[model samples]
Target: MTSHKRKTGRRRAVIGGLSALGITGAAVVTATLLAPAGAASAVAAWPQAKGSKPVPASIEFSGTYDGKLQRHYGTGALGSDGQDESQKPLFVLKDGAVLKNVVIGAPAADGVHCLGSCTLQNVWWENVGEDAATFKGTSASSVYAVHGGGAKSASDKVFQFNGAGKLVVNKFQVSDFGKLVRSCGNCKKQYPRTIVINDVDITAPGTSIVGVNANYGDTASLRNVRVHGDPKKKIKPCVRFTGNNTGKEPKEIGTGPDGTTCRYSAGDLSYD
Candidate 1:
């Protein structure tokens, strides 16, 4: 556990898109882009959260989003960490809730938190403060075609998966963050923490890829994932796996532009 804490703290400081289609809603909340010329436009059509109630349907967001940052949702259980009205996340998808076509602005910590079976599609996060997004608790969830510009600091990561069941992240694009993806799992639970990262593109000149990590007997698989480092910077390997690492060893498939391949053993992986 000492190693775990030390690695977690060290990893803490270190680590760590979009798409298209339909618009269905009567109340079109038009919003302008704070972006420069040629920047795409976005709008928020969904209604804001009224108290502690989840919206009946999925939320499709574009442009900028401020969750009010009035409350902090607990780590586990929808309200497990403790239900306080401190500040709520932008959107808390109830079981089966989906958050798509969303782009988070900078100076924000509360992005999207998933409780149970949920899907996050076509989501883009830019300059996130802390965790751009998270998949909390032991549930089956998937993040599809997500993109992240970077994080506010070098200590924050782009995404975290703390669930015990199956978690799939497909078509993810990110750059300039410490750890690209992290997982802190439970040791006592027997359920496996299976994480599959497919079609991922990461460009962290001096950062660590730190893909899927399960300390307590978990497994991670990386396929068609590419990690690029700045030619002039000193960077670590593309993937790092720590902890007891007693589960199935990590598997990485894919190569870098310069013929850099992934080297995987029990605890570390260098994917070029």
Candidate 2:
């Protein structure tokens, strides 16, 4: 692993999302942005785990694990050296639980992993490996129904709670997904009245994040988020908004025009 021990480290990295329509508790039509919360003072970066040699068989998803250990997970397309697919992402939910600033290649086939129900303030998303989906804290409940932002089998989610969970994201993003779709296409709750994104950034190939054939209506608060993070990686309409799409104006705060979405993967995303 590449550990950059910061002895009074000069600076740490930070990374830093949305959308609308429909009126169903389905998340059947919504979007999200993320912020940071619950992380330790020091964020640890793990080297990309090795990829499957000949591509593992398409694994099937069982369900959630007991309490919060984890049930099933499929490995994402990784590089030989075991790094994340800079282009794609890795399946981490079942394989393991990622916490605070832990770099990921791709999330699980269903969505991000949040084992136990917990409260979050902020989080982030980054694209440092070959190509993968970075995490940004959303909620503390059940798994979310993640969708293919642009790649294949990119639908999956992670949760940290039980019962009718609620996801509250502040900012979100997707970088270098031009040829694929345009951005992290879909992120919703499977059951009705589940999770919801507050702020967001849809940026894939189609010019937007949510697919034309989706209905993930989010009803959370939101703020300034982007599809890209730097000038060199500039796309279009870097930020987005996905207010209480459920028509209820969710519980949210603010962080407008962050202006730092152009740090080229060397920054920490703040949803906190």
Candidate lDDT values, in order? 0.43, 0.28
- lDDT of candidate model 2 versus the reference: 0.28
TM-score of each: 0.51, 0.29
Best by TM-score: 1
Minimum summed lDDT over a 10-residue window in model 1 is located at 23-32
lDDT, candidate 1, 1-272, per-residue tens? 99889755643332211111111121011101122212222322222322332332223344333344222222222321112324345566655565555444433345566766556655555554456666665643332223212233325566665565655555456666776666642223334455555445556643655454333434555544555555543444434343333454344332222112233332222244
Error of 2 at 244 (Å): 23
Model 2, C-alpha of 93: deviation from truth (Å):
6.2
Which segments of candidate 2 are over 4 A away from where they belong? 1-98, 105-112, 115-164, 178-190, 199-207, 210-222, 225-272
